[model samples]
Target: MASKESVCDSYLSLKPEKATIIEIIRSLFSSDLENERFIESSEEGKLERKWIILVSVIVQWVFLYIRVPLAKIGDVLQKWLNLISINGGLLMLFLNWLRGKVVEPDSLSSRSVLGNLDTRIELDKSIKPENTRYKAVLSIMAAKLSYENKDLVQSVVNHHWKMKFIGFYNFWNGYQGRDSTQAFLFKDTQSDPNLIVVAFRGTAPFNADAWRIDFDISWCQFNKVGKTHGGFMKALGMQPENRWPLELENDDQHSQFAYYTIRKMLKDLLQEDENAKFILTGHSLGGALAVLFAGVLAMHDCEYAWLLERLEGVYTFGQPRVGDEKFGEFMKEKFRNHDVRYMRYVYNNDLVPRVPFDDKALLFEHFGPTLYYNSCYGGKVLKEEPNKNYFSLRWFIPNRLNAVWELIRSFILPLVKGSEYREGWFMRLWRVAGLVFPGIPDHIPQDYVNLTRLGTLLLPKETPKVQHSE
Candidate 1:
C-alpha cells in the first residue's frame, strides 16, 4: 500500500545494488542474463498459483461439506469448482508470462548487429547509399559545427540533396537547465522564398537536415514555451526550483506562441518572395508543435492563408497528443489535403506515447493512420500493423479504469480509505506465488512492424536502422 511516489523512490534506491548483483549472477550463469525466464519462473507466476490453489481448495472443501442436498447439486458444485481452479491456474500462468517478457534484459547489442549486416541492406532503399554516406559525412560536419559554435546540430538531412543542414541554439530556462528549439529553413539554387520547411526533432538529437535549416534562419531562437510541465511534471513527481515559462498560463498564450513563432519563421523565409509555399515537418514533439503552430497561423488570418492552404505536409514521428479534442479535430480538417502522418514506434512499451495527457482524444483521433512497430520486441522483427482509424473502446476502457484507480489512490483514497492489512497480505501472497510459475515468450506480431514503417514515412526520409545483439 505504499504510494506510487514512494514505490518509485524505493526502486531507484535499490536499483544500483540490484543491478550489480544481477550482473554478477548473470556472468556466472553464462546463459543470456537479460532473459527473464528465471525471474518469471521463480517469482511471479508459480508463486501466485500456489496461494490461489491453497485458498480455493480450502473454500471448496468447506462448501462440499456444508451444501444441502438438491437434484444434481453435488455434480454442479464439482463442475463449478473445476472451472474456478482452471481459471485461477490460467491467470497465474498469464501473469508469469507477462512478467518474464517485460523484465527480460535486451539481449542484442547494437554494435554486434550493425557490424554484421550488409550496410546496403540496412540502409533504407529510398535513401541511396551515396545519399546515406553523404548524410553520415554531413552528420560529422554538423557535429563539428555545433561543437565550434557551442550549439548542438540536432539533425542533418541527405534526402535527395546534400549541403542541407539544420541547427538550434542551446538555451536553458531558469527553471529547466537546457531547452533546445529547432530552426528549419531550406536553401537551394532555385530557392522558393514562399517554400518554408520546419523540421522537428524526435527522441534523440538533431541530424543534418535540422542543422541546415537551423543555420539558414537568422532570427531563430530556442523555443521556450509550449513545453510540457504542469500535468506531466506532476505525474513524474518533478518540481522545478523556479517558475517555468512554459507553465500553462492560459489557452491564448498557447495559441499566441504557436502563431507568432510560425509567422516570424515564414515571414523571414518569404520576405523576398510572397508567392512561395510553406511546409512544416516535425518528428515527435516537433511534429505536434508544427501542427499547433500551423493552426495558430490559420487562426491569425495571415496573408499566407493560401500558403496554409498549400501547406505541403506535417510529418511526425512517435508524436503524442498535443492539444484538446477541438484542436485535434481542427488540425485534421486543416491538414486534410496536406499529408499529416504520425509514426508510433514502440520498443516493447517504451512508455513515452502513453504519457497521461488532458486530451486523450487527440491521440485517439484526428491523427492519420498509426504505424506500430515491434522491432524492439524479442524474436524476429515483423511487418507493421495499422491502428484502427478512431479510438478503440476496448483499449480506452482498461486505460480509463487504471487512470481512475490511480486518481482514487493518490487523491481520494488518502482522505477516506482506511489502511487494511488484508490487502497487503493478499498482495504479498500473490507476489510469492508469481515466483513459482514457468516463463512465457513475448510474441511480436508482424502487423506491428508495418504500422511502425507507416509512422516512419511521416518523418524526414531517415529510417532508424535496427541492429540485433549477438
Candidate 2:
C-alpha cells in the first residue's frame, strides 16, 4: 500500500509535459467517456431511428419517383442532404414560426391573433349548467383554453356547463421574447357562485422563442416589499426592489402592462361584486405568467391586496419552476396562509415543469403541493419527497432524447408502424430538426390534454371532489 501510494504521488507530481497544437485541438473537440455514455443512452437510438428513416426515405423515393435498386440508397441519402443544405437556417426558422403558430379561428376584435394585440374577447351569457363537478370541469376547460383562439374561446365557454362566459382580455406582450397574454374570466356558476377565474395561456409554440430552452434569466424581485426573512436591522431584511428574477416578474418589452391591467380588472371586478371569489389558472407559459400575476397581487406593496385576498385557488398544468429560494419561500408563505389552494398538475414526463434549470444564480424553484396526474397513483396527489427538488446535468441528454422521440412519435413513428398516416419527407425531417434543436414538442399543450383525458376525452360523469379548492 505504501509503495502504491508513493508511485501514485510520483505520477501526479510528474505532469511537467506540454501538448502540441494538434493535441490541444483534439482535447478541446474530442468525445470522451461522458460523451460515450450519452451515445449509449441517446445517440444509439437516434442512429437506429436514422437508419430506419434513411431506408424508408430511399424506398419511398424509389417507389414514387425512380425504380432504383437498393444499392443506390447512398445516392438517395446524399440527394436528401443536398436538399436540406439548400433549405438551410432560414427555412428552419420559418418552419419553427409556422409550428408555433397554432391555427385557430381568429379573435373577433382582432383580425388575426398573432398579428396584433386584442383588447376585447366576445362573450356568451346564455349557458346554464346541470350538476357539474366544478374543478374537474375547470380542468378540462383550462386545457381547452390553451388550444383555441379568442374567437373560438367564447364558444368553449358557451358549451361548458360549469362556468359562465364573463370575458377575455388579450394583451400582446413578452418579458424577454415576444408573446401574447390572455386573462380569461369565467364565472363559476356551478361550484362557487360569483366565482371568477383568470386563466393565462402558456407559450405559443409558434411564438418567438416558443421552442427556446435557454436558461438565461435576469434576476429581479417577487414584489415591491424589501422584506427578507432575516437581516441585520431586523429579522427579515427588506429588498426594496425584491431582488428576485426580472424575466419572471416582467414579460413585456417595456413594462408589466398585463400585470397592472389585470390588477385593475380584478379590483373593479371584486369591487362591483363583493361576493366574488377569484382563482388564477394557466398552463405552460401562461402558468408562469399566472404565478407572476399572483405574485404581483400577493406582494406587500399591492394597494389592492384586499381585492386579491379573495383568491380562492391557483391551478397550473406543467408549470415551470419560477424563482430562487427566497422568492420561493415568499410564495410558500404568501399562498399557504391565504387559504389559497395552489394545485399544480404535472403530466408524465412533461418537460415544461423541469426547466428554467434551477441555478443558485437564477434561483428558479417549483412551488409545490403538485398533483401528479396519469396512471401514477390514478391522478391523485403525489405525496412523495416533500420540500425537496431535483436537478442534475445528467437530465439534458435524456430530455433531448425524449424530445426527439416525441417528434418521431408524432409523425415518423406512425408512418413506420403502418398507421394510417401520410406526410412528406420534408415535414418529417423538419419536425425531427425541431425536436433535436428545441424539444419544445415535449412540452406541447396537446400532450397535457391527452394526459388529463386519461385515454378518453369524455367529460367526467361526476366532478371529482379532489379538484375543489379550500
Candidate 3:
C-alpha cells in the first residue's frame, strides 16, 4: 500500500459511519472541521464547505443505518416482481397460484428492479448496425443492461444483440472496502473494426450505499487538475492508502480494482486488434465513472496516451457533475487534443445531471456537449440543460404539468408509436409518482433508450460542435 504522504497534497474524506448523531450536528456549528473524527481534511476549510460536508455526512449516516433494511426490501420486491413475471402478469399469477402451478423465479434470473420498471430487454430492431446513430443507440442499451446480473447481461449480448459478451465485473472500492462498482464490456462485431463498449452500472433504486455515493460530497483536490468527487473516485477504484497509481502488483488473494483491472484488459485486447476502438458509457452514477475513466487516463497521459487515442467517445445518460470548473476545462482540453467525441445525454427534467449543486458554494460542474432531449424526445445540442438547478420553485408547476403529459403519453405511445414503444405498468406507476416529483421517472433508462432510437430523427442535420464557453 502507498503511504498517505505519497498521495496528493489536499483531500477531504467523509466517514459517516464513524460519526455520531451529536457529532454530526456539532459539525454544523463548529469551524475546525479537521478535528472532527468523521472528517479528514488537509486544511481548515470555509463555512460553506462545512455545510456541504454536514449534509453529506448526515445523508450517508442515515443510509448506513438503513442499508440492510433497504436491501432486504429491494430483495423481497425483486423476488415478488419476478414471481409475477414468471407467471405472466398479475392476473395469470393469481390464477396459477390458486391452481398450484406457478413457477418460481430463479435466483439469477433476467428480472431486475430496473428491468421490471422498463420491462424492455430486447434492442430496437428498427435501429440496425448500419445506421448512422447505431453506436449511440447500442451504448444506451448497454448502459441499461449493465444494471442486471452477469447471466442476464451475457444472454442479451450473445443471444439478442448478437455481440461478443466480454465480461461483467463487480470491482472493489478501496475506500468502502467492498465490491461496490459494476461494469460490463462487449464487442459490436457487426461494425467494421469492431467497437468495444465499457458500460458501468448505475445506482439501484433501493441500494442505500449507491444512494450514499450520489449524496457524498467529499473531494480530492489535485495541484493542477482540480478537485474530483471523492465518492466517484473511490467507486472508480482510487485507493485511499496508495491513491491513484498507474499500476498495481498482482495478487491472487486480493480482489480486482476497476481502473487497474479494466485498463490491463483493454490494453491486452487492443494489442490483439489494433483497428478496434472502444467507447465508455453509463447512466447516472455510472456516467460519472465512465467520464472519470477517461479523465484518469488523461491524468496519466504519458503512460495511457495510446488508450486515449483509441477511445472513440464517451456516451453518458443522466450523468451528474463530476468535478470543479478547472477539472472540466482540463477534460475539454484533453478531449480536444485527442479528437475524442463525448456525447452527454440528458432527458427532460432528470435531476441527477443537475447536482451536487452547481453553485458558488459547491465546486462541482459538468463539461462536454449535452444532447438535451425533452419529454417528447425532441433533441438539441447544448452546453447545459435547462433548469440548471432542479430545486427551483419557478419551474415546479411546469414540471408537474410535463409529468401529467408524460403519464398521458404512456397510454397513447403504444397506440401511436407501435407496440414496441409500449411501457409496462411499473413504468406507468413511476410516471404517476413523477406527478409529485417529476425528475424521478424522467431519469430512467426507458426515456434514454427512447431518445437514442427516436431523438436521432428529431436532431437537425447540422448540429453544433463541442461548446466550452462555460
* RMSD vs true structure, all candidates: 24.7, 17.2, 2.9
Tens digits of per-residue lDDT, candidate 3, 353-403, equal 999999886778888777888888877777888888899999999999999
Q: How do the predictions measure up, each by TM-score?
A: 0.37, 0.53, 0.94
- Candidate 2 has an lDDT of 0.45
Better by TM-score, candidate 2 or 1: 2
Instruction: Kindly give the number of clashing pairs for every candidate.
Output: 56, 19, 0
Best-first order by lDDT: 3, 2, 1
What digit string (tens of lDDT, one per residue) describes model 1 on residues 1-470? 11111111100000111233354344344443223332211122213222222232233333333333321453354343333333354465467566773222121211111111111112122433234222322211221122212111222233433334432433221111232333344432223332345553332222222221211101101121122222111111122321223223454433223333445556665656556555555444444445555654444333445556555445443444443344455555555544433233333222233332223221222333333433222222223222222234554454344334432333332245332111222223322332331000001111122233222323344333222321
Model 2 lDDT-worst window of ten:
7-16
Error of 2 at 241 (Å): 9.1
Top-scoring candidate (lDDT) = 3
Q: Candidates sorted by TM-score, descending order?
A: 3, 2, 1
- lDDT-better candidate, 1 vs 2: 2
- Model 3, TM vs. native: 0.94
Candidate 1 structure, TM-score to reference? 0.37
In candidate 2, what are the lDDT values of residues 393-454, reduced to their tens digit? 56556646655665556565345533322333434454466455443443444444434433
Per-candidate Cα lDDT values, in order, are 0.31, 0.45, 0.83
